[model samples]
Target: MATVRGEDIVNTARTALGVDYVWGGNSLTSGVDCSGLVQQVYARYGISLPRTTYNQINIGASVSPNKLRPGDLVFFDTDRKKSGPDHVGIYMGGGKFIHAPRPGASVKISSLAEGYYMDRWLGGRRVSGVSADPSSGGGYAEEVAPRLDAHELAETYGMSYAFFKSQPELWKLLNGAVSAQWTPERFQAAVKNTSWWKNNSDSVRQSQVLAKTDPATHKATMEAARVAARQLAVKMGAILSEKNVDQLAKNMVHLNWQEAQVQNYLGAYVKFSSDHVLGGMAGAAAKAIKAEAYRNGVAVTEQSVLNNAQYLVRGLTTMEQVQASIRQQSAGLYPAFAEQIKAGASIQELASPYIQVVAQELGVPDTDVDVYSPKVKAAMTRANAQGQPEAMNLGDFTQMVRNDPAWRKQPGVADKTLNVGRQVLADMGLGF
Candidate 1:
């Protein structure tokens, strides 16, 4: 999962606190309903959400209240007399959620543990970032695994092998399922109306962790995301007038786009326009890439977002792209990755100082985890031909290198190797 900052989402929503409530309104500054307020805040991040409370709750994966994080959508039966979920808010952690609390009230943050909401709490949802999935009119590509490949990992991550094998399209549902907390029955019922959800790669697989994006383009776009979003919305057939587009463009990008009059005749102006420009589905893939960068918790730039869009356009997912980028940089480790894999080592095992040095030496953007699996497989084949057994993991290889007294004296080798060793030692969290 990508590391989305709930703090960021909460802070954006925080900007709208005290705005007047308007029925069916979707604006924060002028006025907005409960769902509108939540929808608008998330839209700024390029996440598309349903306008209505009922639809919003039904779409994403569910989370137990105990696991609630910032940015989660919290549902409620505001009237206590109403049937089903009638109101919603964005959870801001610390037992609080922000919303436009009906007429005569302003947008404000309230507690989930409050008496009125606690009694009527319907549930919470975690939106799955499947923005470019085929079900949502996607244009990106992905590979299909054989029906037989719906094995234990598939089940472990989510879904039962027996069910997906019996129903090929069920794998497609898995993409939406595990990411959020949507139940199988609910997902099935909802997808029944959409033919796209049934069309999935034979077995669902994450393609790649994409390369770091081109920062220049990313900066250019994010700085102008609002204008670009409006223009693209017009291109995609949303009913934004040139005047509306210009007015929208004039404001800061973070303005309430969830406002109905501001964005569309029906609801907030085209919510997913930021992603649509990249590719129908490429946007979510782009978010996934940034999410990984956030998880890596290292240097992040506009390039990370750009790289996400670039690779997703070609059907590579975030992790797959990251691997590809590493391979491009790991030319030195083609031999090392091969040796490690030949010894039947796991990819996790290959994330070592050895891979780190090759990355530095090649001047490629890489973390310890970018060792390519394909080169490892090919190298394994060669090693087996030479009668080598699966004998050395990356750790063992590093130890062997450490033990060799002459390895320290080898010209052009010692500096690079020692630097990596020091760096690895400094990364206290990762176990060799």
Candidate 2:
């Protein structure tokens, strides 16, 4: 069973204080009758009650007026002709109760001492699961001194005292839940559950905190931020002057904008100049730019490359230049593939010797080498281009062929292909 507290119930009910009254209405925001408010508040804390004053009066343990605490259902015989209790409200500490009095009255706090209520007080009943505060003698428990002072607690949670002090209701809710058993973890949970903490944008919350706690320092910081925003605006070709500088600076402080972010946004907005080679390029273009710089033996970081990309990409090799270099390297490394390279064979085609060996491992006959070798080469080209990743690497290609469906389907071919694969490797001065 879940634990329940009258403190929590009171806290929940307080949220609907201004709701309008409508007989039989169940909503907390729009409207709720007296019984509806009590039913809804209990339902939030996982307790269910009858929907009307008459039925709700008998469910919970009866508590006399002197022993009533927050969360006890307070009844009143408002209708003179009615036989039993005809209206209800949830008791809040301090001799007060909250309810939807009638069709015209909105949900509001009312004193039990008020003459009208004093004459009609029916009784108070404590909800079964709502834990009573023995120390309060039937009222809400007095708040105990926290282990850490407010300022210390605020600092521990990375907030200023002023920001913490601004949230009294939130603090009250948290204190009600964990004040008796305060631990750092429990207190931190309370802090994390707050809207202020959940939405604590550093630029807004932190900047606001600084502005309140130390105005002199905050002024200096805002000035610095303003200056940075102006310089960035100028760099990005945005207008900035005395007339709008203060507002722009305040906006920057609120937004947490800095140089790199502004540059990235403006870079995309204006688009890079055509002569600036890498200016507008990103993703694959950026990757190609980095590879080109590396191949050219130039040292450059992604950031540095992006910063001066338009100029940097100009120094990179073109596709034709790369092909010429490959042709030159191929002639020096493998003269036999020179004609094939000149014939426009792809890099995968140049690995024909390895592909033939893989085809042979799949039990492809010598007479079929010409017909099947192309298939093996095609497998190494690219998946989108018709090849598996396993076929891309020469070392993994033979194993891929060995695992091929064609090879596995043949009877008595495995042992013969294994021996053929070994002999093929030996002929190439290599071994498994």
Candidate 3:
């Protein structure tokens, strides 16, 4: 087994300083909720982690809080039910740990001595060598395998060429399976076995319907289906194009229902496109059907498209669900990403807003901007201290920010803007 140094782990955790917290999100960008932060940090150092705090606690040998060191995970049961661990943070040594606190909090360091955290503390686990290597078959090695491949399969089944091309693993898997000597039933069964495919099972059934239907009757059925689908599409598109978040939130329920219908249509369309055995159907009909199907498919499942819309709607709904105290406290807390997007700020300025916004929204002031900034600096500093050849520098930070979602959607933000921001930050001594 190999060891990841304490300083290296701290540095890795620091890089995630301002990432937003999404309940089940673990990615560095879109935002990582609590358990996600810990999972992502350790993963960067080749350490495998469970997706939830409770499961994560069992990852490595248990260590008493007194014996905790940097990179160790600190577990807590905030709910007080004692049912299971509900919150987690990374031990950054010297009685401090880094964590994504809650809805209104960003990733920040907090003292282990704090009464709140100390009372809920469920002890710590050292994950340094938990999963050294999957090929070598270590304790946690299997957990390290990428799960995004499932998403790839979903995107492929959805007939998203752009997503499939971006995710080669999924493309290869599907392409390989398609090329293999399997009947349509076998292929459909294999796809259904995946989590992604299971979520979109409606699409599968719709596809099967299209595949098995008679061509002559299909034309009439198809016309009726198109009319129904287009009406839903028009409604969803109208809601999505609105600028007001409140109206958007209100429209989401309707949109979600419409999305499901579009997904069904997409599935039917993809199956039709790939297995167009009906030689008698005119090319024009084929083309129209295919176009409608692809449009509906993307409308229902593109990562950035549907997910983003869902997120915005959900966030607003959640905000409205909470009490006035939580909402007011949340408003004061400084939205990590939203603040950066106010009025006219460049997207570069908004990078890392996810973590920042979560911290602020959660009303966890102890883990607010003032506390977060130094943690990031310290993480960067420690990375440099470790003498690791690949320690992230200004260039890395700039690249990270530019690639971050905060910058990805801004009005005038482009690759060129990112390069300029990198240059500017470097000149300002913040780069590297």
Candidate 4:
């Protein structure tokens, strides 16, 4: 038997495009059913096929939907009640096929992209003896084959079209190596030889291999990635519409992101966004940390401090919770400020009112209160740093002020000291 060209078989099928449909009828001139149309078309090319859809599906090697070429036999389950393919058509290039319909319909061209056909699509088969050109490239079809559609193949391989298009070498190799009789082993070998594939990540390569070796797992993983992307977007306050979510999911699948990796990415994104926003929870935390760092004489940036506080941000749900976390961190870092923070007053708030009281007691001008307030706080910080008690109080402030030159300069200070000395001496029976 002579080898038949696929293009010739397609031409033969086209000749029966106007023929009427008849159940089990084998003559193309009279009437023919779907399988009859296929049988008669292949007979013209000298390639014998089975008489019915069920047997015809098992005629030769099976074809992936994405790998379908012209002259390949495509099958569908028109009747859901039936167990397997009950309808058949001859695939034409460019997502179309020619087939006869039920009783009154004639043979005509239809699209595989149509919803009805896609939903009912079972699979495709490449019959033996069909070739693009058996005489070319040492009887191999790979050399003379038409370029495979990259967009379709990308979708089949579970990659985004944009990403697939970006890699010129991958698509170029795919179009060059793939033929109607392509297999997963051949495809993997061809792709692995490329520089991009060899240098690519293991997870990504595994996902690509899985798409060919185990389509069911690959599809489920891709779907799970989509769901995870959406959930992470929501959690991070990232505005992701359905379209954005789909693209993100595709990218993740292409990169082979596990759930934990996705969470880390979203967490970093949320932290970066919140830290940059003024008046956000992260800003508040940074501000609090900055104040405590200053009081403790520790040098750090607002951004750095905020980053360090991320540990506290974890598992926290609200702004209030975040605020409380910041306070707790500050108290932990500077134990001396723990009392003031617990009392709901920042270091500045605790120092301001008490500094005014100390200045008034020493009869210092109101204008000097601001100048002395920092000095008093600094003294307290220094004292705490020197192994003193980790508490802030009025007594600490007063003692710090008394030792200062500003307090000693107040009027009537000498006479008051001499009077207090004479009273203490008279009481002890050693009066002047």
Top of the candidates by TM-score:
4
Best by lDDT: 4
Better of 1 and 4 by lDDT: 4
Count of backbone clashes, every candidate in sequence: 24, 2, 22, 0
Per-residue CA lDDT of model 3 for 207-243, tens digit only, reads 3334333444545554554455544433333222223
The alpha-carbon deviation from the true structure for residue 233 of candidate 1, after best TM-score superposition, in angstroms, is 69
Q: Could you tell me the C-alpha RMSD of candidate 2 in Å?
A: 22.9
- Candidate 4 lDDT, 224-247, residue by residue in tens: 978988776665444455776776
Instruction: State the TM-score for model 2.
Output: 0.32
Between which residue pairs do clashes occur in model 4?
none
lDDT of 2 by residue, 1-432 (tens): 565887788888899988889889899999999999999999997898889789999997888776777778899998898679989998887677888999888999976655467668898888787874656355555333234554444454455567555677556744554345454446667776777767767678678667767889999988897787666544543444564567667767776766554544434333233554332333334555555443322345656545433222233334455445545554433344456656765444456566476556665554455312555535433343433233355556666666668777667786776898999999999986
- List the global CA lDDT of all models: 0.55, 0.65, 0.51, 0.68
As for model 3, its CA RMSD to the true structure in angstroms is 36.7
Better of 2 and 3 by lDDT: 2
In model 3, the Cα lDDT at residue 7 comes to 62
Ranking by lDDT: 4, 2, 1, 3
Question: Against the true structure, what is each candidate's TM-score?
Answer: 0.30, 0.32, 0.30, 0.36
